[model samples]
Target: MFDVAITNGLFFDGSGAPGAIRHLGIRGGKLVAISSEPLEEGAQQTIDAHGQWVMPGFIDMHTHYDAELVAAPALRESVRHGVTTVMIGSCSISMVLSGAEDCSDMFTRVESVPREHVLPLLQARKHWNTPADYATFLDSHPLGPNICSFLGHSDLRVAVLGLERAVDASVRPSDAELRQMEQLLEQALDAGLLGLSSMTNPWDKLDGERQRSKSLPSVYAPWREYVRLNRVLRKRGRIHQGAPNLVTKLNVFAFLWESMGLLRKPLKTTLITLMDVKADPWLAPILGPLTRTLSRLTRADFRWQTLPVPFVTYADGMEFVVFEEFPSGEAALHLASQDLRSELFRDPDYRRRFREDVDKRFGPRVWHRDFDDAWIVDCPDQALAGHSVGELARARGMHPGDLFLDLLVEHGPRLRWRTMIANHRPKVVEKLVAEPATLIGFADSGAHIRNMAFYNFAVRLLKLVRDGEARGQPAMPLEQAIWRLTGELGEWFGVDAGRLALDRRADLVIVDPQHLDAGLEAYHEDEMEGFDGLRRMVNRGEAVRATLINGRIAYRDGEFAADLGQVRGYGQFLRAG
Candidate 1:
């Protein structure tokens, strides 16, 4: 008898094809039968989709849920958004291959995850010595979605060289240290890691004693180190995921050329996270050259991953990672107490210095330079809601920076701001999405849990493409959007879970297209416990009627199923082929 049967549903098979009404039968956690004829002979449970669209559950290719998977295993927020599988360990940050203390600080600095919450969880549950140990630890926990990981380059450096030297940009690993890193990577691959992930973004800083330190350890590594690692990944036919230096277009192009062209044997799949085209006008001119280079490359399949919408960050205080870009801003960010930070902001000298330093260094071209882009989303004063900083500053006859500091000082830690950091042009994003080689990613789900929200891109894109217009044209068709979010990502990651077919794992989502706009707004929620009441942006998935993982109903009717009896561990650790 089949475990469950879904009938009369509009099925999008994740292949960019038109939806068709079909019946699906599930047994032993796999799709056993998919036929136009209903097979209701023997089924333990049945779901009448009633014209709802049944598509493969979404796969988020870029996320930072490495530590959170152990700290908060339920992962309900992601599951609610129709994400059935998540790829963590992005930007070269993973839980394994480093000590718990180092991992905690690195995560806190780079990803903005709370160290207090992560450290204890790592100490109590995580096995930090090896990748096999880490995987075993994850298996012991109950997960809501299937988890896959990449071996972090920073973790490898920390494991071999100490944290201090790893972050030192001047230091390069010796021959022995390089060999050790290679051996560790091989061991990690053997233990089921999917690939290698690294980042060279100048903005990715480490937590230093007095202030934020230099770039991540991986960035300091010479080109030889990356080429060697690429060779290792090539041998296994694995992917090489990276976030290139976005500060300069030449740096981005150089990384791509070296990674793909200079290597003896090019990496199979090299994916780089591209900055939002509208975020910086400087990046817009490079897109054409980048695309041309990608097209000319014969050795590797080079592609860029981008967000379908602008990158937004909602914060109650100035503790976000982006603020660390300013001089002395890192010192201000380390002040854990909001009251202390408010006092610092109230200091006249500090405020003046901060304003002068920012103006001198960044000028007017930076994305965050225009205070009008920042809106007061949440505050004690309801009158200020939806108002931008520029408007309020002009009314008070003060500089925007001065007014912003004064407001923070007045409100202390209770104030909240919503800032758009990238991708102001939806038309540009649509054009990028329309490109067959572009991958829609950069969700950044678990890392910036308290400060930013991009976790519900799958559902948001679906709605946008169908109803929203961009560049005087409607967004891509729903079928194409589904394929980009599902099959394309699954194919790139070498996973079989993103398609609805016989013999595939039965991870499915049933959605009501008519009510897709309902409950789609992003709101604040305090879900992570023991993290100083920090609130994360929760994008509600209103249209999702049900989500099934491996043939079992994980969520239904806007609530997670109770059948698991509070032990929701239906997900498996997907190893690379």
Candidate 2:
């Protein structure tokens, strides 16, 4: 008899094929049979998914859940949204291959993960000194979704060079250091890490008050280092993922050419965090030619990972790293005391400098030329709540910057503001989403916890695409959308569980499309330590009837499966085949 059976469902199968009525049989945590025949009577458990659509569970290709996995083993936010597998250690940040103290600081700076939350947990747990040790550590603490990690280049550098020297912009790894890094990569790959991930975006800065904080360690690595790394990845049949410098078209195009063309054997390259650069209109023109050039490259395969939703940031204060783009913004962020920062905002000279810097740096396009797009979401003064910064500035006959400072002075630094950063152009977003080459991910889950919550993006996108279709202009077929989230990404990353075939891993999600909701509500939860009212976003989609991981029901009927004991580590640690 099967362990469980799901009957009478419309199955999308994650194959980009049309949906059809099907029945699935699960046993020993694998899909043993899928057919039209009803196999419910002999099963120990049965789910009558009569009106739902069953598809392979989603694979979130980009996330920063590396450190958070141990602390929050349930991974409720991700599993609730039907994500059964998560790819962590993206943008070159991972806990393995480095000291715990250094990993804690790096997680705090690069991913906005609280040091207090991670440090104490790491101290209590058995130390993981190598990638294999880390994998074993993860295996001991099971989560709701399977996790696959990449060896972070930053941590690799820090392991070879001390943390102090690793961040030094001028310092380059010597031949010996490079060889050490290569050896570590080999060890990590053998230990089940997918491959190496790096970050070269100049804007991707480490959060701290110290010098050499301008860019991540991977940014300072010479091109030859990357070439050597790529060669190593090719030798092991692994992929390379990174965020290329996108400040200019030439920078992006050149990086692509070099990354793809430098090595004799093409490595599967996944470039991440691609978005609609509203600040630079020339980016659109550059993408067209660059994509064509990448297409012509025979050896390498390239795909851009993007978040198709509007780029909105909701933050309580200048603590958000995005504000660091403006001069002196970094200084304000580094101030340990919120009251001290508030006092600084009240200073006339400081206010003047902020105004001048904002004007000089961002000019009118700071809010994408729409000042009304930036508004106060929560404030101490009830009258100011939901009011735009522009409106308040106009009322006081003050510059927006001055008014912003005045508000901070009045309400302290904890006033919450929501700003539309980019991707406000619906047509542009639609175009990007429709592109076959673009991978539908960049959730940044388990990172930027307080500043923003994008963990529910998968369900949100499903609702958006379906809702658009109901309005007549479909973004893409539902089958295609499923494929983007599942088979396409799973295949590219060499994961075998995205498709709903016989003998495949039973990672599945059941959705009632007719009842799916587009709106998501953000709430504060004390999930992380030291940070009060940490924000988490949850999909309101009651349509998700059940989600199964490895044939075990992880979530069902708007609740996580209660049958699984207290240590609900039902998830497997996925390794590249």
Candidate 3:
């Protein structure tokens, strides 16, 4: 007798292959059969998945669930969206320090955790310090879904050569330090981590603080280390890399192609498309040559993901602020939002001259939406929505910029002013998704807390890709999207869950594609740790009817089962091999 049976559904097995209408039988948490053959006389529960899509559980390749995963292992936000596995420690950040005395204090630099709150909690709970120790502790927990982590480059660099010295190019690493980094990687993998992850872009704050502080230059490792590390991990692990300093439109894709060209051993690279600073309609043309280069390359498999939107924070004076290394990126950020930054925003003459100079150098480039043309679409309470700054200024008979500053001044320097910056052109997003090599990702959740959240893209893509096109359907088959979201991602990351094959982890979702919906209404009130922010969301998959991780029902009809250990300890560390 089987443990469970899902009868009457279209099975898209996450293999980029065609799906068939069939009944799926499950026993001991594995898909026992998919057939017209008679299901064995019942030994357990049966779910009638009538008129639904039954496919492998999704594997979210990019996410920033690092801190939260340690605190709340249930992975509520992701699991509810039908994501059964997640890749953490991207952008070259992770918690691999040893004996941090206070986990919260450590997170202040590594994550967005506020000092006062995280400090106390992490201090009380941080028992393990090394990557191996962190993995062991998390693996022992009865999590709602499986987790795979990448050894962060920053953390490794910091660990091997303290934060101060790691970036000091002059301070050549001794043999001891070099061996230490290699040892950390080995330990982390042995403890169940997959491979290493590094960021091409330095953290924003690092650039801001460099000015006036005489900060150490960032130690972006040479290609040799990356190559050696890739070779080491490829023997038994995998590598997930985010591109270097994103200043230009094709910076990420360009650097990735160059890096792949350098590697003697075949390795996979995931290229991230950060939101664009320009509003040019011809953005696709600029990206075309790079994408063409990507198409011609077969030396290594590459994955592409995009960050579709930017965050808006209305509580604090945090408006649409984008910073790059200018003078010093670090010192500039620290002063950018300060009273000093007013010089950049308030002085019309200065702003106009700066714009004029920039244009003369690089042609007319669009940055944020012009202050005069900006509007207020959403606000914290009912008092402030559907009004433009210009309109607000006219009402008060003040300048538009004056009105915006007044609102911020009233809320104090800490008061927030949020703006919705839509950088994606539907056509561009469509072209990227149409490619088989691309995977949907870059939901930097839990990291950019002050920013808006739109990480829930599974259903959103259906609306945009399916409904946004001329034919009112997707360019790629729906089955292909489903496969990428589930099986292909799992296979790429070596995750155990995203398939319906026998012995596959029972991470499944029943989707009602017809009734699927996503938008403002789907945004939930919960902020995990009470951080004020907006979340883009959607509702679909028939309430996720039942969630089985490793064959045990972790969630069913909004109710979690009594025991949650079936899915526990099943995740294996992914190595390059």
lDDT of 2 by residue, 1-577 (tens): 9888999999888889988999889988888988888774588889999988899998988988877676666677788778899998888888887776667666776677666667676667638879889888777775778888999988888898887788777788889989998999999999889999988765556544453255677877887888878878888888888877644424455446544645465567778745676665545434644674665654446777877687787766565666655556756765767788888888888888888766664432223433466688888887888899889888888898888877777776468888777666776777677675578898888887766677767666777788789899888888888888889888888867679888878999988777666445344444552234454433355767788988998898888876432364477788886
Model 1 agreement with the true structure over 1-577: per-residue lDDT tens digits: 8899999999999999989899889998999988899885688989999768899999988888887777566677788878898998888888788887777767777887766677777778655589888778667667778888898888888899988888777888899988998898898888888888887766677663533466777878887888778878878778788876655535655555644644455554445655553346566436734564675664446677877766777766565676766665765776777878888888889998877755553432234656787788878888888999889989989888888888888885567887777776766667767665568888888877767777788887887786664334677777889999999888878876689888989998888877667357547575663344655666775778888888889888888876432464477788877
CA error at residue 300 for candidate 1, angstroms:
3.2
The TM-score leader among the candidates is 2
Give TM per candidate: 0.92, 0.93, 0.81
Off by over 4 Å in 1: 208-214, 259-264, 268-272, 275-279, 282-289, 334-343, 346-349, 357-366, 468-473, 529-534, 563-569
Per-residue CA lDDT of model 3 for 284-374, tens digit only, reads 4355445546655746556666543332323234322242333322333355346666544456664444344322434323344344445
Give the alpha-carbon lDDT of every model: 0.76, 0.75, 0.57
Q: Residue pairs in steric clash, candidate 2?
A: none
